[model samples]
Target: MSKVTPSNIEIIEIPKIEDPRGNLAVIEKEVLPYQVKRVYYLYDVPSSAYRGGHAHKEQLECLIAVSGSFEVVVDDGASKQKITLNKPNKGLLIPTGIWRELENFSSGAVCLVLASEVFDEDDYIRDYKQFLDFKNQ
Candidate 1:
Protein backbone atom coordinates (compact mmCIF):
# COMPACT_ATOMS: atom_id res chain seq x y z
CA MET A 1 0.00 0.00 0.00
CA SER A 2 1.09 3.52 -0.68
CA LYS A 3 1.60 6.11 2.02
CA VAL A 4 -0.66 8.62 0.33
CA THR A 5 -2.90 10.71 2.55
CA PRO A 6 -5.65 13.23 2.20
CA SER A 7 -3.04 15.95 2.62
CA ASN A 8 -1.54 14.84 -0.66
CA ILE A 9 -4.74 15.74 -2.42
CA GLU A 10 -4.69 19.00 -4.31
CA ILE A 11 -7.06 21.51 -5.75
CA ILE A 12 -5.84 22.00 -9.31
CA GLU A 13 -6.58 25.18 -11.15
CA ILE A 14 -7.39 24.83 -14.80
CA PRO A 15 -6.67 27.55 -17.27
CA LYS A 16 -9.72 29.68 -17.86
CA ILE A 17 -10.12 31.97 -20.79
CA GLU A 18 -12.47 34.91 -20.54
CA ASP A 19 -14.72 35.74 -23.46
CA PRO A 20 -17.55 38.15 -24.07
CA ARG A 21 -19.88 35.31 -24.86
CA GLY A 22 -18.84 33.03 -21.99
CA ASN A 23 -15.84 31.78 -20.05
CA LEU A 24 -13.83 28.78 -21.25
CA ALA A 25 -11.76 26.34 -19.27
CA VAL A 26 -9.17 23.86 -20.51
CA ILE A 27 -7.65 20.73 -18.93
CA GLU A 28 -4.86 19.49 -21.10
CA LYS A 29 -1.15 19.79 -21.72
CA GLU A 30 0.75 20.34 -18.46
CA VAL A 31 -2.34 20.70 -16.34
CA LEU A 32 -2.30 17.08 -15.21
CA PRO A 33 0.49 14.89 -13.95
CA TYR A 34 -0.67 11.81 -15.79
CA GLN A 35 -2.22 11.40 -19.20
CA VAL A 36 -5.94 10.83 -19.08
CA LYS A 37 -6.94 7.34 -20.11
CA ARG A 38 -10.62 7.46 -19.28
CA VAL A 39 -13.24 10.15 -18.99
CA TYR A 40 -16.62 9.94 -17.27
CA TYR A 41 -19.26 12.08 -15.68
CA LEU A 42 -21.99 11.85 -13.05
CA TYR A 43 -25.27 13.61 -13.54
CA ASP A 44 -28.94 13.55 -12.54
CA VAL A 45 -27.99 12.77 -8.96
CA PRO A 46 -30.52 13.36 -6.25
CA SER A 47 -29.55 15.70 -3.44
CA SER A 48 -29.71 12.91 -0.89
CA ALA A 49 -27.97 10.42 -3.13
CA TYR A 50 -24.34 9.48 -2.64
CA ARG A 51 -21.60 7.98 -4.75
CA GLY A 52 -17.99 6.84 -4.66
CA GLY A 53 -17.56 4.85 -1.49
CA HIS A 54 -14.30 3.26 -2.44
CA ALA A 55 -10.61 3.79 -2.88
CA HIS A 56 -8.41 3.13 -5.86
CA LYS A 57 -5.24 1.09 -5.67
CA GLU A 58 -3.50 2.57 -8.68
CA GLN A 59 -5.77 4.89 -10.57
CA LEU A 60 -5.50 8.65 -10.19
CA GLU A 61 -8.68 10.65 -10.56
CA CYS A 62 -9.38 14.31 -11.14
CA LEU A 63 -12.93 15.41 -10.45
CA ILE A 64 -14.41 18.66 -11.68
CA ALA A 65 -17.83 20.14 -11.19
CA VAL A 66 -18.80 21.27 -14.64
CA SER A 67 -22.31 22.41 -13.80
CA GLY A 68 -23.47 22.72 -10.20
CA SER A 69 -21.64 21.70 -7.02
CA PHE A 70 -20.88 18.78 -4.74
CA GLU A 71 -18.77 17.70 -1.79
CA VAL A 72 -16.05 15.08 -1.67
CA VAL A 73 -14.88 13.54 1.56
CA VAL A 74 -11.42 12.02 1.27
CA ASP A 75 -10.01 9.74 3.93
CA ASP A 76 -6.65 8.07 4.24
CA GLY A 77 -7.49 5.59 7.03
CA ALA A 78 -6.20 8.17 9.44
CA SER A 79 -7.29 11.63 8.47
CA LYS A 80 -10.14 13.08 6.43
CA GLN A 81 -10.97 16.24 4.58
CA LYS A 82 -14.18 17.49 3.09
CA ILE A 83 -13.87 19.47 -0.11
CA THR A 84 -16.52 21.37 -2.01
CA LEU A 85 -16.15 21.53 -5.75
CA ASN A 86 -18.27 24.17 -7.44
CA LYS A 87 -15.98 25.70 -10.05
CA PRO A 88 -15.56 24.32 -13.54
CA ASN A 89 -11.98 25.56 -13.63
CA LYS A 90 -11.01 23.71 -10.49
CA GLY A 91 -10.60 20.00 -9.86
CA LEU A 92 -9.79 17.74 -6.95
CA LEU A 93 -6.89 15.38 -7.57
CA ILE A 94 -7.02 12.11 -5.66
CA PRO A 95 -4.09 9.78 -5.53
CA THR A 96 -4.04 6.09 -4.75
CA GLY A 97 -4.63 4.61 -1.27
CA ILE A 98 -7.15 7.19 -0.20
CA TRP A 99 -10.83 6.52 0.43
CA ARG A 100 -13.39 8.90 -1.09
CA GLU A 101 -17.09 9.56 -0.78
CA LEU A 102 -19.08 11.95 -2.94
CA GLU A 103 -22.29 13.53 -1.76
CA ASN A 104 -24.33 16.68 -1.31
CA PHE A 105 -24.84 17.26 -5.01
CA SER A 106 -26.90 20.19 -6.13
CA SER A 107 -29.56 19.85 -8.78
CA GLY A 108 -28.38 19.33 -12.33
CA ALA A 109 -24.86 18.86 -11.13
CA VAL A 110 -22.42 17.39 -13.61
CA CYS A 111 -19.23 15.86 -12.25
CA LEU A 112 -16.62 15.38 -14.93
CA VAL A 113 -13.94 12.86 -14.07
CA LEU A 114 -10.59 12.37 -15.74
CA ALA A 115 -8.91 9.14 -14.84
CA SER A 116 -5.46 7.73 -15.44
CA GLU A 117 -6.69 4.25 -16.11
CA VAL A 118 -9.67 2.34 -17.42
CA PHE A 119 -12.23 0.75 -15.16
CA ASP A 120 -10.87 -2.26 -13.33
CA GLU A 121 -12.69 -4.00 -10.56
CA ASP A 122 -9.50 -5.43 -9.15
CA ASP A 123 -8.15 -1.97 -8.49
CA TYR A 124 -11.00 -0.93 -6.30
CA ILE A 125 -11.03 -1.33 -2.52
CA ARG A 126 -14.70 -1.04 -1.75
CA ASP A 127 -15.04 -2.13 1.83
CA TYR A 128 -14.00 0.41 4.38
CA LYS A 129 -12.56 -2.27 6.64
CA GLN A 130 -10.66 -3.78 3.75
CA PHE A 131 -9.36 -0.35 2.85
CA LEU A 132 -8.18 0.13 6.38
CA ASP A 133 -6.40 -3.17 6.27
CA PHE A 134 -4.84 -2.23 2.96
CA LYS A 135 -3.62 1.01 4.40
CA ASN A 136 -1.91 -0.72 7.28
CA GLN A 137 -0.10 -3.12 5.04
Candidate 2:
Protein backbone atom coordinates (compact mmCIF):
# COMPACT_ATOMS: atom_id res chain seq x y z
CA MET A 1 0.00 0.00 0.00
CA SER A 2 1.13 3.54 -0.65
CA LYS A 3 2.15 5.61 2.32
CA VAL A 4 -0.38 8.15 3.47
CA THR A 5 0.70 11.72 4.05
CA PRO A 6 -1.04 14.92 4.96
CA SER A 7 -0.67 16.11 1.37
CA ASN A 8 -2.24 12.92 0.02
CA ILE A 9 -5.62 13.45 1.60
CA GLU A 10 -8.02 13.82 -1.31
CA ILE A 11 -11.44 15.32 -1.75
CA ILE A 12 -13.61 13.18 -3.99
CA GLU A 13 -16.77 14.37 -5.68
CA ILE A 14 -19.58 11.89 -5.53
CA PRO A 15 -22.12 11.72 -8.32
CA LYS A 16 -25.39 13.41 -7.52
CA ILE A 17 -28.80 13.23 -9.13
CA GLU A 18 -31.21 16.05 -8.56
CA ASP A 19 -34.94 15.74 -8.26
CA PRO A 20 -37.85 17.94 -7.28
CA ARG A 21 -38.56 15.94 -4.17
CA GLY A 22 -35.01 15.39 -2.96
CA ASN A 23 -31.45 14.81 -4.11
CA LEU A 24 -29.37 11.62 -4.10
CA ALA A 25 -25.65 11.04 -4.15
CA VAL A 26 -24.11 7.69 -4.99
CA ILE A 27 -20.87 6.34 -3.42
CA GLU A 28 -19.15 3.56 -5.27
CA LYS A 29 -15.76 1.84 -5.11
CA GLU A 30 -14.74 3.30 -8.44
CA VAL A 31 -14.32 6.73 -6.92
CA LEU A 32 -12.25 5.53 -3.97
CA PRO A 33 -8.73 4.25 -3.85
CA TYR A 34 -9.67 1.36 -1.59
CA GLN A 35 -12.54 -1.08 -1.39
CA VAL A 36 -14.85 -0.38 1.47
CA LYS A 37 -15.34 -3.13 4.03
CA ARG A 38 -17.27 -1.22 6.67
CA VAL A 39 -19.77 1.62 6.80
CA TYR A 40 -20.82 3.71 9.78
CA TYR A 41 -22.39 7.04 10.59
CA LEU A 42 -22.24 9.49 13.50
CA TYR A 43 -25.30 11.44 14.45
CA ASP A 44 -26.98 13.30 17.30
CA VAL A 45 -23.66 14.76 18.32
CA PRO A 46 -23.73 17.60 20.78
CA SER A 47 -22.12 20.79 19.52
CA SER A 48 -19.47 20.63 22.24
CA ALA A 49 -18.55 17.04 21.59
CA TYR A 50 -15.63 15.92 19.44
CA ARG A 51 -14.95 12.55 17.87
CA GLY A 52 -12.23 10.53 16.20
CA GLY A 53 -9.02 11.33 18.05
CA HIS A 54 -7.04 8.45 16.73
CA ALA A 55 -5.01 7.01 13.89
CA HIS A 56 -5.41 3.74 12.07
CA LYS A 57 -2.52 1.46 11.34
CA GLU A 58 -4.00 -0.29 8.35
CA GLN A 59 -7.48 1.00 7.73
CA LEU A 60 -8.24 3.69 5.19
CA GLU A 61 -11.42 5.74 5.42
CA CYS A 62 -13.59 8.11 3.44
CA LEU A 63 -15.57 10.57 5.54
CA ILE A 64 -18.60 12.44 4.27
CA ALA A 65 -20.97 14.87 5.83
CA VAL A 66 -24.22 13.43 4.61
CA SER A 67 -26.15 16.04 6.55
CA GLY A 68 -25.23 19.38 8.06
CA SER A 69 -21.48 20.09 8.38
CA PHE A 70 -18.29 19.48 10.34
CA GLU A 71 -14.54 19.86 10.25
CA VAL A 72 -11.88 17.18 10.14
CA VAL A 73 -8.29 17.82 11.20
CA VAL A 74 -5.74 15.43 9.77
CA ASP A 75 -2.11 15.14 10.90
CA ASP A 76 0.86 13.17 9.70
CA GLY A 77 3.26 13.96 12.60
CA ALA A 78 5.04 16.55 10.48
CA SER A 79 2.13 18.39 8.93
CA LYS A 80 -1.56 19.02 9.55
CA GLN A 81 -4.59 20.21 7.66
CA LYS A 82 -8.20 21.02 8.36
CA ILE A 83 -10.93 20.01 5.93
CA THR A 84 -14.53 21.07 6.00
CA LEU A 85 -17.34 18.74 5.05
CA ASN A 86 -20.54 20.56 4.31
CA LYS A 87 -21.88 18.78 1.24
CA PRO A 88 -23.35 15.34 0.78
CA ASN A 89 -21.69 14.87 -2.60
CA LYS A 90 -18.16 15.34 -1.29
CA GLY A 91 -15.88 12.94 0.58
CA LEU A 92 -12.47 13.18 2.24
CA LEU A 93 -10.24 10.17 1.92
CA ILE A 94 -8.05 9.47 4.95
CA PRO A 95 -5.45 6.82 4.49
CA THR A 96 -3.60 4.65 6.98
CA GLY A 97 -0.94 6.07 9.30
CA ILE A 98 -2.53 9.49 9.56
CA TRP A 99 -3.90 10.92 12.79
CA ARG A 100 -7.35 12.48 12.66
CA GLU A 101 -9.57 14.55 14.87
CA LEU A 102 -13.18 15.60 14.25
CA GLU A 103 -14.51 18.86 15.57
CA ASN A 104 -16.77 21.83 14.95
CA PHE A 105 -19.84 19.78 14.24
CA SER A 106 -22.93 21.76 13.41
CA SER A 107 -26.23 20.84 14.99
CA GLY A 108 -27.72 17.61 13.65
CA ALA A 109 -24.65 16.94 11.57
CA VAL A 110 -24.24 13.40 10.30
CA CYS A 111 -20.85 11.98 9.44
CA LEU A 112 -20.73 8.91 7.23
CA VAL A 113 -17.58 6.87 7.26
CA LEU A 114 -16.56 4.27 4.72
CA ALA A 115 -13.72 2.10 5.96
CA SER A 116 -11.37 -0.18 4.10
CA GLU A 117 -11.11 -2.69 6.94
CA VAL A 118 -13.26 -4.34 9.54
CA PHE A 119 -13.13 -3.27 13.17
CA ASP A 120 -9.78 -4.20 14.66
CA GLU A 121 -8.68 -2.84 18.00
CA ASP A 122 -5.03 -3.54 17.26
CA ASP A 123 -5.12 -1.35 14.22
CA TYR A 124 -5.85 1.78 16.19
CA ILE A 125 -3.44 4.25 17.78
CA ARG A 126 -5.41 6.33 20.18
CA ASP A 127 -2.68 8.41 21.77
CA TYR A 128 -1.11 11.30 19.91
CA LYS A 129 2.35 10.61 21.33
CA GLN A 130 2.19 7.00 20.26
CA PHE A 131 1.06 8.08 16.82
CA LEU A 132 4.08 10.32 16.52
CA ASP A 133 6.39 7.51 17.57
CA PHE A 134 4.84 5.19 15.05
CA LYS A 135 5.21 7.76 12.31
CA ASN A 136 8.82 8.46 13.16
CA GLN A 137 9.69 4.81 13.01
Candidate 3:
Protein backbone atom coordinates (compact mmCIF):
# COMPACT_ATOMS: atom_id res chain seq x y z
CA MET A 1 0.00 0.00 0.00
CA SER A 2 1.08 3.58 -0.68
CA LYS A 3 0.59 6.68 1.40
CA VAL A 4 -0.94 9.78 -0.12
CA THR A 5 -0.28 13.49 0.28
CA PRO A 6 -3.06 15.71 -0.90
CA SER A 7 -2.20 18.55 -3.17
CA ASN A 8 -2.57 22.10 -1.96
CA ILE A 9 -5.84 23.65 -3.02
CA GLU A 10 -5.65 27.25 -4.15
CA ILE A 11 -8.48 29.50 -5.18
CA ILE A 12 -7.77 31.36 -8.41
CA GLU A 13 -9.94 34.10 -9.67
CA ILE A 14 -10.45 34.22 -13.40
CA PRO A 15 -10.37 37.73 -14.65
CA LYS A 16 -13.62 38.71 -16.27
CA ILE A 17 -13.54 41.26 -19.02
CA GLU A 18 -16.77 43.13 -18.98
CA ASP A 19 -18.63 43.87 -22.18
CA PRO A 20 -21.95 45.29 -23.20
CA ARG A 21 -23.41 41.93 -24.15
CA GLY A 22 -22.00 40.02 -21.17
CA ASN A 23 -18.62 39.02 -19.74
CA LEU A 24 -15.86 36.75 -20.93
CA ALA A 25 -12.91 34.89 -19.44
CA VAL A 26 -10.28 33.31 -21.59
CA ILE A 27 -8.31 30.41 -20.13
CA GLU A 28 -5.03 29.79 -21.83
CA LYS A 29 -2.70 26.84 -21.53
CA GLU A 30 0.16 28.27 -19.47
CA VAL A 31 -1.44 31.55 -18.57
CA LEU A 32 -3.76 29.90 -16.07
CA PRO A 33 -1.10 29.85 -13.27
CA TYR A 34 -0.49 26.20 -14.17
CA GLN A 35 0.10 24.47 -17.45
CA VAL A 36 -2.93 22.66 -18.81
CA LYS A 37 -2.86 19.59 -21.02
CA ARG A 38 -6.43 18.30 -20.72
CA VAL A 39 -9.80 19.99 -20.36
CA TYR A 40 -13.08 18.39 -19.32
CA TYR A 41 -16.58 19.43 -18.28
CA LEU A 42 -19.14 17.63 -16.11
CA TYR A 43 -22.88 18.19 -16.02
CA ASP A 44 -26.25 16.47 -15.68
CA VAL A 45 -25.30 15.11 -12.25
CA PRO A 46 -27.88 13.94 -9.70
CA SER A 47 -28.11 15.03 -6.05
CA SER A 48 -26.89 13.22 -2.88
CA ALA A 49 -24.26 11.49 -5.13
CA TYR A 50 -20.54 11.71 -5.73
CA ARG A 51 -17.82 11.44 -8.34
CA GLY A 52 -14.01 11.17 -8.45
CA GLY A 53 -13.35 8.47 -5.90
CA HIS A 54 -9.67 8.20 -6.71
CA ALA A 55 -6.40 10.04 -6.56
CA HIS A 56 -4.00 10.94 -9.32
CA LYS A 57 -0.40 9.95 -8.80
CA GLU A 58 0.85 12.73 -11.04
CA GLN A 59 -2.07 14.63 -12.42
CA LEU A 60 -2.77 18.15 -11.19
CA GLU A 61 -6.16 19.68 -11.76
CA CYS A 62 -8.24 22.82 -11.31
CA LEU A 63 -11.99 22.67 -10.94
CA ILE A 64 -14.49 25.44 -11.37
CA ALA A 65 -18.26 25.58 -11.27
CA VAL A 66 -19.18 27.52 -14.32
CA SER A 67 -22.90 27.53 -13.72
CA GLY A 68 -23.88 26.55 -10.18
CA SER A 69 -22.25 25.05 -7.07
CA PHE A 70 -20.58 21.84 -5.90
CA GLU A 71 -18.35 20.43 -3.17
CA VAL A 72 -14.93 18.86 -3.62
CA VAL A 73 -13.71 16.55 -0.89
CA VAL A 74 -9.97 15.91 -0.84
CA ASP A 75 -8.07 13.52 1.34
CA ASP A 76 -4.34 13.36 2.02
CA GLY A 77 -4.20 9.95 3.71
CA ALA A 78 -3.77 11.62 7.10
CA SER A 79 -6.27 14.42 6.75
CA LYS A 80 -9.14 15.66 4.62
CA GLN A 81 -10.31 18.98 3.26
CA LYS A 82 -13.52 20.18 1.68
CA ILE A 83 -13.93 23.05 -0.74
CA THR A 84 -17.06 24.62 -2.10
CA LEU A 85 -16.95 25.94 -5.63
CA ASN A 86 -19.76 28.14 -6.89
CA LYS A 87 -18.47 31.20 -8.69
CA PRO A 88 -17.72 30.95 -12.39
CA ASN A 89 -14.51 32.93 -11.99
CA LYS A 90 -13.17 31.03 -9.02
CA GLY A 91 -11.38 27.67 -9.22
CA LEU A 92 -9.84 25.11 -6.89
CA LEU A 93 -6.45 23.61 -7.70
CA ILE A 94 -5.87 20.00 -6.69
CA PRO A 95 -2.32 18.78 -6.77
CA THR A 96 -1.13 15.24 -7.42
CA GLY A 97 -1.40 12.30 -5.01
CA ILE A 98 -4.58 13.56 -3.40
CA TRP A 99 -7.75 11.47 -3.25
CA ARG A 100 -10.71 13.55 -4.33
CA GLU A 101 -14.46 13.10 -4.30
CA LEU A 102 -16.88 15.52 -5.90
CA GLU A 103 -20.37 15.81 -4.46
CA ASN A 104 -23.33 18.05 -3.70
CA PHE A 105 -23.71 19.22 -7.25
CA SER A 106 -26.53 21.64 -7.97
CA SER A 107 -28.92 20.69 -10.74
CA GLY A 108 -27.75 23.18 -13.35
CA ALA A 109 -24.16 23.14 -12.23
CA VAL A 110 -21.43 22.86 -14.81
CA CYS A 111 -17.98 21.85 -13.64
CA LEU A 112 -14.95 22.53 -15.77
CA VAL A 113 -11.69 20.79 -15.04
CA LEU A 114 -8.28 21.74 -16.33
CA ALA A 115 -5.78 18.96 -15.99
CA SER A 116 -2.00 18.82 -16.11
CA GLU A 117 -1.93 15.62 -18.12
CA VAL A 118 -3.94 13.48 -20.49
CA PHE A 119 -5.89 10.40 -19.45
CA ASP A 120 -3.62 7.79 -17.90
CA GLU A 121 -4.81 4.88 -15.81
CA ASP A 122 -1.38 4.40 -14.26
CA ASP A 123 -1.65 7.77 -12.58
CA TYR A 124 -4.73 6.85 -10.58
CA ILE A 125 -4.50 5.63 -6.94
CA ARG A 126 -7.90 4.12 -6.16
CA ASP A 127 -7.36 2.43 -2.82
CA TYR A 128 -7.19 4.52 0.34
CA LYS A 129 -4.91 2.10 2.16
CA GLN A 130 -2.61 1.93 -0.80
CA PHE A 131 -2.47 5.68 -0.91
CA LEU A 132 -1.41 5.84 2.72
CA ASP A 133 1.28 3.23 2.18
CA PHE A 134 2.58 4.98 -0.90
CA LYS A 135 2.96 8.27 0.91
CA ASN A 136 4.81 6.68 3.81
CA GLN A 137 7.36 5.20 1.40
Question: lDDT per model, in order?
Answer: 0.92, 0.90, 0.82
The worst-scoring run of ten residues by lDDT in candidate 2 lies at 1-10
- Candidate 3 regions exceeding 4 Å error are 1-7
Q: Model 1: per-residue lDDT, tens digit, 1-137?
A: 12234758888888999999999998876998999999999999999999999999999999999999999999999999888999999889998998999999999999999999999999999999999999999
Query: Highest lDDT, which number?
Result: 1
Better of 1 and 2 by TM-score: 1
lDDT of 3 by residue, 1-137 (tens): 12222455677777778899988986765446567889999998987878899988889898889999999988877788788889887778787778889999999989999998999999998888888887788
Give candidate 1's whole-model lDDT: 0.92
Arrange candidates by lDDT, descending: 1, 2, 3
lDDT of 3 at 107: 93
Which parts of model 2 have CA positions greater than 4 angstroms off? 1-5
Q: Considering summed lDDT, which 10 consecutive residues are worst modelled in model 3?
A: 1-10
Candidate 3, residue 125: Cα displacement in angstroms equals: 0.7
Candidate numbers, best TM-score first, in rank order: 1, 2, 3
What TM-score do all the candidates reach, one by one? 0.95, 0.93, 0.88
Each candidate structure's count of clashing pairs = 0, 0, 12
Which 10-residue window in model 1 sums to the lowest lDDT? 1-10
